[model samples]
Target: MQVWLDSLLALLSLPQYGLTTLFVVAFVSATLLPMGSEPALFGLLKLNPEMFWPAVLVATAGNTLGGALSWWMGYGAHKMADKYAHSSHHLRALAWLERMGPKACLLSWLPLVGDPLCAVAGWLRLSFWPCVLYMAIGKFGRYVVMTVALLYIWPDS
Candidate 1:
């Protein structure tokens, strides 16, 4: 079992799979999933430093698509909000999301709740283009800063 798992991990870590994995992982990470895409981006960069810009762009595009999906989900979740009102968490989040408007989507780069924040923005019917633009900026900025910082701080890793 361990050998099989190791082989699968090795296959995923290969250069041929690197870019596509980065994009898909980044996209899924931006969704409601608990996964993190940073390690994938960093691994790809460490393996092929020449593809830095392309990798970042691909990651940015994937993350943006995920954010767009989140928005659509929120747009479709109108009927479920009532059922969730028993939890003050959802209520407060919805209220805050409504009040902050599209500008709040800028923080969608954060961990844990950030992914849902994008969906909530969509739920509130915030400006579409602006929300997309903000998500791209934040997600791209994260890829740039976090990946670069990780490389610099943990060169041996």
Candidate 2:
């Protein structure tokens, strides 16, 4: 099992598969899951410096899509909550989200709260298109800044 996993990792590290693997990692990382796509992206960039923009674009797209999926999940969860549970705290959070609107999605690039912020935006029934636009911008900035900073800090890495 370990050997198979190692082989798969090795295959994914290859230039032909690196961008796809980075996309998957970025997508998953943008969800509620506790994962980081930076290392995968950094590794790919270190291996193929020429693919910087492609990798950044791919990561941003995957991460934005993942955030949209989180938004959908939050929409469904909000519907369920509306049907059943309605605590003061929940109402307060919903109110906050409503007040903030899609502009709040600018924080979707944060480490822990980022993905959940996308969900909360949906939970508040905020405008979907605006939220997506903000998410894309924030996520794109994050990918570009983070990848470039990492490369600058450790060029050989």
Candidate 3:
């Protein structure tokens, strides 16, 4: 069992696949999809201990770009809101988004609602630079803290 686990871990640890997987996972996770990027970071770190910072940065970039994409989608979907007005959830979502403003983008690192939050920000035509800044901050902080915490608890990680 130990050997099998180690082998599996070793495979996931490789720099190429691990890093690519991190970007892919982080990107998808930042899109309204119920996904996570932490496991990818942990997996890569476990394999290539020296790649800690690189992995974090890569994940952040990928996630940030994904958030940007969601923002564009929202910007484009503005006209479609009326088409889906029958859905109470969509109405509430738009209303809540209107109430929060761009600052709500600070929580863009969160799951489920985070991606959609970014889209709404764009749809509302909030200040672009500020939203992007907040998104990057939130996303980067998340990766940094999670990675550091995981490594601290498990040095071998």
Candidate 4:
């Protein structure tokens, strides 16, 4: 097990597979897990400057997919919590979500609240396709902005 784990880590660290690694990192980071994909993205771009746009796009795709997964999880959780659907807090939260609508997903790129926002969007049963579309746009913008800033600040040194 230790050997396999080490090998997997080594493979993920390889610059030759940087984009794939970036995708995985971005996906996992977008989940409820406590992780960040920015470092992985920055490292990959530093090693392979030619793949800037591709890397950003891949990261955006992966992260957006992860957000969708979170949305599904929230949907599932909501289903399981049907018993509490009538609670005051639950009703209040649901009302707030209804007010926000799918546009709330535009904030899905934010760090802390981002992932949970996706889940909440799902929990509220907001329109899935619109939420996903907003998530993709936000995630793509985030990747592009962060990658560009990192490249500018660090250069190719």
Query: Could you give candidate 1's per-residue lDDT for residues 1-157 as a string of tens digits?
Result: 9999978767776768877898899889888989988888887888788888888898999998999889888878856776777788877877887777887888989998789989888777888888999999989998889878877776886
Write one digit per residue (lDDT tens) for candidate 2, span 1-157.
9999988878887878998899999999988999988889888888788999999999999899999989888887876666534688777766777788898898899999899989888777788999999999999999899888888875765
Candidate lDDT (C-alpha), each: 0.85, 0.87, 0.85, 0.87
lDDT of 4: 0.87
Per-model TM-score on C-alpha atoms:
0.86, 0.86, 0.79, 0.82
Stretches > 4 Å off in candidate 1: 1-16, 85-92
Report the lDDT tens digits of candidate 3 across residue range 36-110: 989888868866879988999999999998898889888888787668877988788778767877778989988
Count of clashing residue pairs in every prediction: 0, 0, 0, 0
Residue-level lDDT tens digits of model 4 in 11-89: 7656668778888999999899989998888877776778888888889999999999999998888877789988998
Model 2 / residue 87 / CA error / Å: 6.0
State residue 154's C-alpha deviation in candidate 3, in Å: 6.0
**Runs of candidate 4 exceeding 4 Å displacement:** 1-16, 80-93, 154-157
TM-score (C-alpha, index-matched) for candidate 3:
0.79
**Candidate 2 Cα RMSD (Å):** 2.5
- Angstrom error of the Cα, residue 106, model 1: value is 0.8
Model 3, residue 28: distance off in Å is: 1.5
